[model samples]
Target: MTRPGGTTIKNSRRLKVRVKTGKGRTVSQKTWLERQLNDPYVAEARKLGYRSRAAFKLSEIDDKFRFLKPGGRVVDLGAAPGGWSQVAVQRVKATEGKGKVIAIDMHGMDPIPGVVIFHKDFYDEDAPQLLIEALGGEKADVVMSDMAAHATGHRQTDHLKIMALAEAGFAFATDVLKPGGTFLAKVLRGGTEGEMLKMMKRHFESVRHVKPDASRSDSAELFVLAMGFRPID
Candidate 1:
C-alpha cells in the first residue's frame, strides 16, 4: 500500500527472530537488535549501501517536498555516520562537481566522496564560518540538521535539548542560506514553540512539519521544513 510521502508499505510476513540473551547482552540491547533485524528499511539500506535507515527519512521528505536540487550548495549539521550527507550529495549532484555538500559533526565519521566534512562541535564560534568558507563564499541553498541530543529517557528534557539544537541550526542557517533557500531540522512533537516558530514564519514563505515513514511510528521525532527564505538587511 502507498502511504503518505510516497512510501510503499510492503505487507509481507516473515518469521520473527528472537534474540537469546547472552552473558554480555542486556535485555534492552537484545530488544534493539531484534528491532533492527526486523526493520525492512534497515535491510534495504544495507542492500543499497546507504549508511543508515535514516537515509530513507531524508529521501522520503525530499521526494515529497522537492527540495535538495541539483547544483545546489547544502550544509548538514551533526552529519555523523553520513547517511543524510550521502543522500544530499546524490540529490545535489555534488559528486559530479556541479554542487557542494558541507557536513559537520562532533563525532568523527568516515569520509564520503563529494562531501567536505568537519569533525568538530557545531557550538564552536568558528564552525559556521568554516562551512561558509568551504562554500567558497557562495550561500547555501539548503541547511539541514538531523541532530538530536542523547536521550536522557526524560521526555521533556530530551525535547528541550533537541529544540535547542534546532534553534541553533536555524540561527546558523539564516547567516549562510541564500535568499529563497530551505532550512530543515528535526524536532520532537511540541518542540517548535514561542519565538522560534514566530521567527520562522516571518523569515520564510512557508513552514510545515513532516514525519516520514522511515521514522518509527512511536517516535516523537518530526522534521520542520521552512522554504523561501526572506533575507533581511
Candidate 2:
C-alpha cells in the first residue's frame, strides 16, 4: 500500500464494515461501498458536516505546508461537491471577508458560503476571462486542483489521462497566480516525473510530490505541490 510522503498509517483495530453482494450489485460497486462504509475519514467527514472525505485531504496538506493562509485569494478547479472549496473557505477566512475563494466546475453543486462559484467547465473559451474579471486584477495566492479523470482501471492509461488534467490545471494557474503563488494538482504515481514535473520546475521555486494520509493506502493518487511561482519574463 502507498502512503503519501512515504508515511505509514496503521489501520486502527475496529469492527470491520462489510457489504454483502446484493441483488444486481456488481463486485466493484460492493467493494467501493464496503470501503466507504469502513473508512474512518468518511465517518469523520459526516460528523464534521463536510461535503466529502476529500475535505480532510486538503486540510492535512495545508496543515503541513501552511499555504492556505488567511487573507489569501484561492482558486479551486474542478470544485464539484465543493469539498476542497470548503476547506479553502475556512483556511482563507473568506467568510470573514478577509480573503477570496473562487470555485469553478462544469457540474453543479449546492452553494458554499464565502465562495464565488462558476458553474461552467474550466475549458470553456470564456472561463479564464470570467475568473480573471472576478479577481478584479488581483492575482491569486493559490490555485489548487483535485481533479482526476474517471479511472479506466488501466494504470498507464489512467495515469496519462490525469496527467493531462494536471498539466492543463497548471497552464491555467500560470495565467492567474501571483509571484510566490502556489499550484497544487493531483497526478498519479506513474510518470509523474515526466514532462509535467519538468515544466513546473522551470516556473516554481520548489516542487514536491505529496500524498496526504487521507489518500487511501492502496491508491495511486498523489498531488504535485509547486510553490513560489516565477512568472516568465
lDDT of every model, 2 decimals? 0.88, 0.87
Q: Can you give the lDDT of residue 6 in candidate 1?
A: 43
Clashes of 1: 0
lDDT tens digits, residues 1-233, model 1? 44223445445356788899999999999999999888877777787778988888898899899889999999999998999999999999999998999999989799999999999988898887788899998889999999988989898889899999999999989988999999999989864454577889988999988998889998999889999999987
All candidates: TM-score = 0.93, 0.93
Q: After superposition, how far is residue 218 of candidate 2 from its true place, in Å?
A: 0.9
Off by over 4 Å in 1: 1-13, 191-195
Model 1 residue 76 distance off true place after TM-score fit, in angstroms: 0.5
TM-score of 2: 0.93
Q: Let me know the TM-score candidate 1 reaches against the reference structure.
A: 0.93
Count the clashes in each prediction: 0, 1
